[model samples]
Target: MALTFTEEQEELRTTLRRFLADKAPSAAVRRAMDSDEGHDPLLWRQMADQLGLHGLALPEEYGGFGGGPVELGIVLEETGRVLLPSPYFATVALAGQALAASNDEAVKARWLPAIADGSTTATLALAEASGSWRLEDIETSVGNGTVSGTKMFVVDGHTADLILVVARTDTGTGLFAVDGDAPGVTRTRLETLDPTRRLARVDLDGAPARRVGPDGDASPYLRTVLDLVAVALAAEQVGGAQACLDAAVAYAKVRVQFGRPIGSFQAIKHKCADLLVQIEGARSAAYHATAVAAEGSSELPVSAALAAACCADAFTHAAKENIQIHGGIGYTWEHDAHLYLKRAKSSEQLFGGPATHRARLADLVGI
Candidate 1:
């Protein structure tokens, strides 16, 4: 089957690209990454208020545009194109999905509007001190509507208005939403290699929380949320990969070597060709996963896993090769090649990494 973009999708993509080009050019991205907040709040507001992006995937009742996973995938892909330094992915892609999957209407009513309007930023506090993303490995305890434990590498943890924490209860793993400034909640930002994406180590010392769903049957819901995240992230990976490929190709045509353009060299030509092939393949995988997510079919899980793993590898490989094609300039901090590389690495590890997804895909197929 072939993947085709709807008119709305094409329009959305064009608007976002123009917005980024005007508001967040490469210099602005570099400045944001170099800033303490690691992002620009003004640009975020433009994306939320001006574009209504925060609400794109939310229901209409929640002040959203009533779009679904496919819309979100489109937004993520555009965000990847410019490497927009914001927490939209962590907030919308993961936390929004977590809330949507919750069984509690009260929680949804309270949080979804804020999220949809960009009045609130939320993140999933799932990865523990052991840094394991599995439900079984979540050792944080939830008791008496209170939670206690340390959640590491929480995306936007420090900046979130709310935190959806996955903690272990007596019954099993459960989802809880704790206030960002709730008492007993402490945070420490890690000095990470990727400055564009912020992560924090969150410590919950019996922090008061509102339980969103039951504890025992969280595995299935968790899988669904993860699949949705993967679908959107795969689109982002493909976008990043395509950006890298274009950069490499453009540089090869312009950069001179041996008294001739690098594009004339057989080695650089082969490298660009390989990168283009990988990007096309990754685009196919990402489109398939997005379709499966939108359809909510039984094949969603396997397709999402396959797409996530393949996109991660493809994007990472293409990004590294792009830098290599740029030679010494790509390695410098002054160049934009490293930015794509950092994003590729961070995104690859976001949803349990390639190995994790491949293993999950294998198990999902009962192989």
Candidate 2:
């Protein structure tokens, strides 16, 4: 298969990169993170209404642009580079995918258009306080058109207009869509290392809910969404790693040490070289996974697992080394290196860690 992007994809990437550069600059990101909603409402609208990024991966019939995973990857990669602090991942990635996977026309009509237009924010209350993304670890329950349980570290849970909760039913595991402001739903914001992406602990006590799919059917679909999530995160990680590498390299070239540029030193040169190599490998995995996700093949899971594992290692390594390369300044909060480090660690654990993905890969390929 051709590894390079097509002309249309390249144009798409250029558009997103420019948009993010202008709208999601570092200052903008910091401002959004500090805001009560933890994101910029205006920028969100621009992305949806102007760029149509919110609907890139959504179906055309549902008021989306009729694109797929690759287009989403383009936006995600750009967002990662700038560390854009928004609910895009929670809303566009998780909630959007769940809604797309559902067969409920009423549900799609109710939420997809709003999501596509950026008028509504959405998230998934799937994981528990134990912070497990595994199917077996889910303990939420739904009965008589209501839900009850605790979901913790839910991405943008506090501000979501719609929430897709994974609940255990009498038949099997299922997905339930709940109104974010519905009665019996209480959200508590949690202070986190990655404040740019807000996390919340949600308590749902007989909250109004609607089933999205048949019992047990959610497992495969959830797995597919998780794979997509992994792909999106991998794209983000690769972007972050690339940014760190660039920052470190630029700093080393100008920073004086022993009457010369530190980049001229063998130690620093070797470190930067190693980081570039790792980033190159990670980018390959990330891009390949995105393509595979768009194609919707049987090997999608395998591709996603590989990409996630590679990205986790790459982003973590690059973030740490970036700090080292920045010397004492990197340790300070004033420097942007620490922010990348925090994001790297947070993304690494969001879905499954590297070990978890590796295990899943073994199972998927029967290795």
Candidate 3:
């Protein structure tokens, strides 16, 4: 499908880009990353109150704009470009999407308004100690109205007000809602490569749990949710890739070597040109996936897999090439280049690596 944006979508991108450039500058990002909360709460409120970002893609009855994946993708792309340190992704992309996709109206009524108004932070806990994202691999068990298991690599798990936990039941895999501070729940922040994003390990020892979706096997619904999340993440990856490309090109134009701008050099020019192509390709893939998701197409599985692989590889490549173009400065801890590289490397493995997505794509297409 052709990747096109409406005028309103374009305006959203422009507005969000300007807002982030003002509110989430490099210094603000560093401050948030180093803070215990891992993000600026006041800034978070501003995003909801001023931009209605928290409700951009939520249902209208739940205090949102009744938008869809495409709208959410636009917000994510802008945030990724600035490397904004916030729980927005965990709250909206991971947990919000899951809740919105759930069949239980009670669950949505009880939780979504809090999320929409920015009063609650939430995350979806799927990966276990095995570090697997597959639903069938889940070993966490739920019995007698409680869930017991340890979840690893949970985004913002330590601090979220709500945690949507994936657990195995007698029938099949299911999603459970466990309060972050509920009795028997333990959340620990884990040391990670990307300071801009926080990850946690959650131990739910017979925690009182409320089933969020269907009563029986929810694997199919959960799978769709995962696909949606992958597409959302791809949007973010494209934004990050574009940022790296822009930074590299800008630096090349100003930093002179051999009595001329490095951008005039064939080697630097080639690297920048290549990065631009890769980023644009990734952008298209992400945009296409978002469009597929918004339309609820049957082609979603194929499109999501394609996007997951393409965008991850492109972002990682762009980040590395950006550093190389900047020479020694990019390698320094003081420079922002390393930050982008860290985010790229970490995000590449978040849902699964590029290779994993490609393997899934092959299976999906019966290749």
Candidate 2 residue-wise lDDT, 1-367, digit = tens? 4567889889988988888888887888888989987889888888888889888889999899888878788778888888898889889988997788777788889889989988889998777878889888888888898999965568889889988998888877888988889999999999998867789999999999988855554788777878888898899888899899999999999999889999999999999999999999999998999888888888899999999999999999999999999999999977889989999999999987999999989998999
Candidate 2 overall Cα lDDT vs. reference? 0.88
Give the top-scoring candidate (TM-score): 3
Rank by lDDT (best first): 3, 2, 1
RMSD of each candidate? Answer: 1.4, 1.3, 0.9
Could you tell me the TM-score of candidate 2?
Answer: 0.97
Each candidate's lDDT (Cα)?
Answer: 0.86, 0.88, 0.93
Candidate 1 residue-wise lDDT, 261-355, digit = tens: 99999999899888788788888888888877777788888989899999999989988998999999999988999989998998888768999
Model 3 scores worst on lDDT over the 10 consecutive residues at 149-158
Which prediction has more favorable TM-score, 2 or 3?
Answer: 3
The clash count of every prediction, one per candidate, is 0, 0, 0
311 Cα displacement, candidate 2 (Å): 0.6
Q: List the residue pairs that clash in candidate 2.
A: none
After superposition, the stretches of candidate 3 with alpha carbons farther than 4 Å from their true spots are: none
